[model samples]
Target: MLSILDRYILKKYLGTFSLLLLLFIPIGITVHLAEKIDKILENEVPMTEVLIYLYNFTIYFANLLFPLFLFLSVIWFTSKLANNTEVVAFLSSGVSYYRFLRPYIIGATIVCAAALVFSMYLAPKASKGFNEFAFKYFNKGRSDRDQSNVYTQINDNDYIYVSYFNVTEKIGSNFTLEHFEGNKMTYKIAAGQIKFNDKDSTYTLFNYSKRKIGETNDILKTQHKLDTVFAFSMEDLTPVTYIAETLNFTELNDFIKKEKARGSSYINRYEVVRYKRWSLPVSAYILTVIAVAVSSVKRRGGMGVNLAIGISIGMVFIFFDKIFGTMAEQSSFSPFIATWFPNFVFGILAIYLLRNAKR
Candidate 1:
């Protein structure tokens, strides 16, 4: 039992969003292709591989810039309604402003659900495929090791450190592992170089030395070659930039838990990604409210003026998101705060504008 007005607004909202996505995605693909064409030709990549890359890129780009497109679409269609005086007619017909906003909320909910699904499942797969394709074909000689000066907690009693690690070869230099009991160091192992044997699932330590601490004295052992097993694996030593983007919501949470346990320095960046997945969907509701409030009032300059305003606001929002995201990744800023601060600030603005629009 839906009202005619509700159906009309809902249709316009969803239809406009679809149209905008279709219109802009090709332009995005074209620009991306133009930039990457030289790399494709230089690498002598096949057309079939290029097509698959573009397919994955489509999903990646759409999910990446979802909010901007949604904001512009809302502004475009709502401004059209305002220019036609449809909003005024509806208001004059005894529909309160809050009631008039219902269809917008409904429409946003639908889009938000879709966004959540995309981010949780589809986007991760697309991101993995896209990054893998780019790295395999375009980024020749690029190393996979994401960081230097790596430190990790192997377990409750063991810790490890590596001055540098090579992900391509599964090797590390200047490696140290320490085992502690309460406040006392029980034993320590050091190696000049360590290589992981994937077939054997063990480490080969060159120039290895071990120290066993005792109450009265310490015993030391030295060897030129040593093979041993640890609680961790090569994946633990080499973290990739795209690792967070490849995991779904459930996998992401588990990853965060494991990384936290391991005292990973990259945990901040991973947490930011986790928070943003949910925040992206929630922002759909916030942006829809702000969009309607901004574009519902008819202006002398027409749709172009409204679009200008919408684009300006969209740019500001994106700027804030990037700044805060960088802070979370580089500094000690909490990822939750960084992710939600933009929403809180913009939500207040939405409320202010909605009150003004009501009057």
Candidate 2:
């Protein structure tokens, strides 16, 4: 059903991409191991855990740079074809530039689908393992979540606050919970300290006191210690900064919905993660078009010139992505725009370059 030219280019596209992954992933692992080996040894981390961490780190690293790798692979192989005059011969024949682009589009489709799967499921699992191991070993005494002055609305009528929370221990100090009926406060509970029991899904509050507000007077009750159930979990106090990254597509959607209801300060951060899952994969098509257009013309500067140009473009794209992503996370910038802006700008570039290549 396919022509020989299509098959040949498609084979080259996928093979080169695979080769780049194999080449770079090891270097990434080696660098990461070199940096963390001292901490790993000092912590006495198990060899099995270290191996698993590396496995997770591979997926995490690959997912983070998938688009760049794909972009470079397309440039590398297409530049080679241009250097050999194969692309020139095909275009000089009866084949149109669009016809020549067909295999690249097919290759982009394959990569896009695979990338979607990775972002939706595999990458989240790897992120959870990778970040958990880092926090447990490499970042001891430091937390990956906001741990001070945490406030959350558990429901329409219930709100909770904690002065300080310990994520590792699932404990909080200066905890308070308030219940409201319409505009009036119904009751409030305060605790000197609180600990969550994971086994029983309960909470232990030390030096607990409850105040029930009335029209005339307030009734107060006190206890040295109390074990009670609350509608909220320990995560409600202060979820990790990367919690959104560790959830799969379905879970992320659900989490965003809940966080929205709770008026979370990190909503933009979560939304950025959500939008990137789709945007990153879609960039494959735009980058592929740009790569082919950049490399299909034979130049005196040769493949090196094409690669240099490609790497520069790749670095710029990554720069735009990281800057905008950080702005969205740290400020009130629109996450949708931040996530898609790089792709949109480069898509325009792809079109312009593609027109020139056709000419």
Candidate 3:
């Protein structure tokens, strides 16, 4: 039961967006492949893995730049409509400006839903593969985890520290574990070096010593080498920096809960990722409105002028998003505020522009 005008405009909106993605994704892949081909050749990476990496990279790249694609696509087609005086004809035919905007809103909703799905599920899977391949082949010898001066609370009464950890080797120097009971030290374990045995799921401590506190005296035990099991996993020592990006919505929530319980210092970073998953999809509507308003008025300079304006606005939006996101991740800034501030600012802009366009 859709009107002809609604069908026409909706078709144009979705068709233009789809065409933009089809055109740009291949260019992105070509550019990426060109930049990384040398490394791929040197590493002798298999063709099968390379193809899989490209597939993941496409999703990662698309998700990262979806808003820009959407904005530009809207501007492109809307400008074309304005240049052809289609908008003027529609408005003259007793269609109010708001009525004229119906199809665009419908298109935005569709895109927003798809974006939500991508962020919640598809993007995380792609991110895991994308980051894993980059770290494994392109960034060998570099770690995605903090390998120096590691400290963490594994559970309520247990804390561990290491001066330096080798993520690849699963080894550490200057390892110490402390147990406390009601603000009193219960026992402490220290070792000059520690190595995890993956096969046995145990730790081997060199120059190991343990001190047990008593009401009157402290009992000390020392050994040249000791093998034992602890209440923590090796992953608890140093989770990869991108660990938050690899988990889907539910998994991410569960992970953040566990990390919060463990007193993780990277909670802000994780929360930033969590908030962005929702924020990015919402921005689609704001950006769509802005794009239509900016491009719906025919200009003397034609479509190029609208495109210039769109690109500048897009760049500023991305800049604000990255700057605030980084601040939230690195500082005590609220992740919710950081993630949504750009959208809030741009939404106000969208309102102002829409009002002007109506005039």
Candidate 4:
């Protein structure tokens, strides 16, 4: 808690991290400007708008590589110290290699925990504003990406069949509600359209008809020409809160609950994303441990060589992560494995490297 060496190492790691971000952001801006100059000019977008949008989008790129940046920074700085024999000096001066690891672990713990909060508590809410701002002014807003077909469900029971739903225009078409207490259909309602009134928490149907069956092969039919209201929420269609990347953990969980009650089919993606968010943050700690361990030891190679290796490893990790996630989304792999396998593998590797660093 009070060692100067620990502080020094923490200072080095954080200082380099800050410097990398500061430098990379401006470079990112320049690159974005050069790439988007044509569209910005052609769309007659304001320079200020372009600047603002690009600034927000910069976070997207920076976040994707933040761990790599942190890891490389540790490798770069610590490797330099090792190559200069400072590590040997420390070792000679009553400091064990394991003792020197204290600062790295401490710093990594803080960073990883902070990253977890950022991804789970902050990122989506921020992205909502960021995306709106980008779309409204910078990129010219478009219709929402989520679309769904209508389904017939009694009180959102989802035991019946529905054809499709229109999000832009609040309407459900070819709706059929089937009631089955056990293995038989006790009732069925086929409606032409379902109209939703969100503010009032109700819905209206147009050109609707209902059919009922009783024991002894008795049947009853009913029809309605005018509009009628029933409790309905547009959320039943797409369940915005459970769309994985769109909502943070708390909100997503709430959405999952609501949709689960309705017997939604796509809940797996949301759960996978929630678990992955926690796993990814932990990965930052694992990567940091490996980076510091590899660099903290005195070696014949310098910072450049170690940094190159670190960056390469980090890129490969990121690639496999994306690949596995895609495969999971496509139902080619188990969601649990796809989401956390890379982190699990790398975490083991980090432990091995840290052991060697002690030797």
Off by over 4 Å in 2: 168-170, 197-207, 216-227
Candidate 3: clashing pairs of residues: none
The deviation in Å at residue 167 for candidate 2 is 3.5
- lDDT tens readout by residue for model 2, 1-359: 77999999999999999999999999999999999999999999999999999999999989989999999999999999999999989988999999999999999999999999999999999999999999999999989889999988899888899999987788899999999998888999999999999999999999999999989999999999999999987778887889999999999999999989887888999999999999999999999999999999898999999999999999999999999999999999999999999999999999999999999
* Predictions in order: lDDT: 0.92, 0.95, 0.95, 0.71
Model 3 off-target regions past 4 Å?
A: none
TM-score of 1: 0.97
TM-score of each: 0.97, 0.93, 0.97, 0.82
Give candidate 1 misplaced runs (Cα > 4 Å).
none
lDDT of candidate 3 over 32-86, digit per residue (tens): 9999999999999999999999999999989989999999999999999999999
Query: What are the per-residue Cα lDDT tens digits for candidate 1 across 187-238?
Result: 9999999999999899999999999999999999999999999888887777
Residue 225's C-alpha lDDT in candidate 4? 52
Distance from true position, residue 45, model 3, in Å? 0.9
Q: Is 2 or 3 the stronger prediction by lDDT? A: 2
* Comparison by TM-score, 2 against 4, better one: 2
